[model samples]
Target: MSGLGFETRQVHAGAIVDAEAGARVTPIYQSAGYVFDSFDDGVERFAGRSARRAYSRNDNPTNVVAARRIADLEGGVDGVLVASGQAAIAMALSALAQAGDHILTTDRLYEGTREMIRGALRRQGLEFEALPIDADEDAWVAAVRPSTRAIYAESIANPLGEVVDLALLGRVSARTGVPLVVDNTVATPYLCRPVEHGAAVVIHSTSKWLGGHGSVIGGAIVDGGGFDWTAAAARFPHLHEPRPHGAPSFAERFGAAAYSAYLRSVVVLEHGPTVPPSSTFLLLHGIETLSLRMERHVANAVAVADALQDHPAVARVHYPGRADGQAERVARLLPDGAGSIVSIDLAGGRDAARTFLDGLRLVSQMTHIGDVRTLAIHTGSTIHGKLDDAERAGLGITEGLVRISVGIELVDDIVADLEQALDAVLAAGERTATRRSAAAQLEAVHP
Candidate 1:
């Protein structure tokens, strides 16, 4: 399978036929528990002596299929599926860090991730620091503290359209003995494999591109199988500590898959954030077409961004494919494609932004990105609206900012919808200005 190409991997990686039924499609094992052959087998399973399903909360057949496929696709030893992207991050962080421990994160992360660090994790007695994603290698090394357990960043930052230099970041990880945890949701495994770039852990929100049609919400954590967790025993006491049934030490027992095994066995089993079997099936269905779907998604996004740049009402368009200020970074890291998302700033303010949104007929006005349907969202008024003016500015989100998740639709149709919407906004502004002037003139004549 390692010798197979990506197209072959996408179609055949996760789904091997069911042992009993010989089913071609991965069967959904929706049952909560599996029957053990005997009392001895059940005891062995509980003691971690035998490898079989003890409970659905611990593992599921359908979910494992998706997990195994993702692991193979990303070149990881093992992968675990969670309820959502945030869950994946939370579980990964909890598995690695505890009270008094710290993590270094990129400043350009998703707002939800930033909020989780600043609002919740910090309150729990953990320290999280933010650094510029495009910082110099020396600057990143300088930011590391003795308490730092992991360096976290997105492979490609959402909305901002900036790509982190994974290779350089990997070097920083190697120098400081920190495992780099990358959110590979935006790029997916098709465009980039973070493990090859030196990431110890790769995380993805399968709700986005992985579940290509945006039907199911899921997340995955892939262990890169390279980091040496045993040597960092003092940094990660949880992995070194004893287990309930005197199970083997995580690093010694699981080897390269220590992080992933800990996440599923401890974090998920104890907390129970299991992805449903139906959702798992939906995700599996989407993954079969991942390579094909993403190609069109990237192509369509580039064309839409090109059209966006020419519109008069558009102040600026942020698409990595366009080769602007972040062109060097895109060229270096994402030479294949910029990705499916495009962030734009309209000339008019919030009101005009709303007008443009209302004027759209072909595209959907939804918050979620990376779907087959073209979608648009104004962050200042929707997704990032909770942030204060200063906070929004720090995030590079303006009052006029709108994020577009370009889909695999016809390029001409996407451009036409945008063009007409911008025209309608300008037309409405002219009418309002004319009315205001007429009222002022009338008042002067009456006086």
Candidate 2:
């Protein structure tokens, strides 16, 4: 499996064959608890002396196969599957930083993540600071305080599609002695593997591109097993300290797998955002065709972006593959493709957005992304609606911004649908101007 290709690994990497039934596909082990052979067997499993399923909350065979497959795809040592992408982020961050600790992140992140960091995490005593997405390396390093325990960013930012400078951030991580944690939800493992650059942990909303379709909602945390948690003992005392019964610390017992072990055993298990076997089964099926779907996704996205750039109603297009100053990064980091998401800012503002959205014939207007069918959403009124005006502007989410999750549909059909919608927006704008001119003339006559 180590020397195999991506497509091959997708189908065969973590598959477990059923001995009695000879089942080729991974069976859904939906049992709440695995039966023990004897009393000693149960004690050994409970005491951590043996490796076997004790409870579904901690681990399940079906979920384990899915986690292993994702870990292999992302080039990680191990992975943990949770209920949703938010759980993955929470578990990974909580495992590394405690109350009163600080986290450094880029400004352009998923709106849900922003809400979690500012609302839930802050109320729980964690502190967070945001640096400009295009900030200089020196500035990023300067932002690191003694309490800063982790550096976080999205591999490809949502809505805006900003590509992270991984090499520069990797250097900052090295200089600051803090692990870099990246949310790779937008750019899946097939497009960009952050661990290959220098990320210690990779997070994914399995509901997105990884799932290909919008059918399942899940998340995963992948540990690269590269960060030295013990070396930074003072900064990460939990990993360095002994267990409740005076057992060896996580770092001593698990070595490179310390963070992952802690995340699974303590954070995920205690918090109870565990992914069920059924969802894991769906996720595994999605991974098998990831490569195929991604190829079509990238092709359709590039075509749609090219068409949108020339539309009369579009003020600006924000696709990385088409943007200036992003070519070099795209060529280096995302040679396969930039991604399938394209966002366009309308020239006529909110009214134009409503007209375009309402007139669309083929593209479905929705709140989700990374589906087989094209999906559209007005970011300002939806995802980023909860943010203040200033915060939304800082993130480049304007009143007229519309995000398109280009699907694996026919390119011609997608373009035709978008063009028709844009045409409707133009006609609506002309009607408004005509009405305003008539009102002015009436006012002059009355005066």
For candidate 2, write residues 217-249 as lDDT tens digits: 999999987777877788889988888766788
**lDDT of candidate 1 over 299-319, digit per residue (tens):** 998888888897888889887
Tell me each candidate's RMSD, in Å, in order. Answer: 1.5, 1.2
For candidate 2, give the lDDT. 0.90
lDDT of 2 at 279: 82
Return the TM-score for each candidate structure: 0.96, 0.98
lDDT of model 2, residue 377: 92
| Clashes by residue pair, model 2 | none
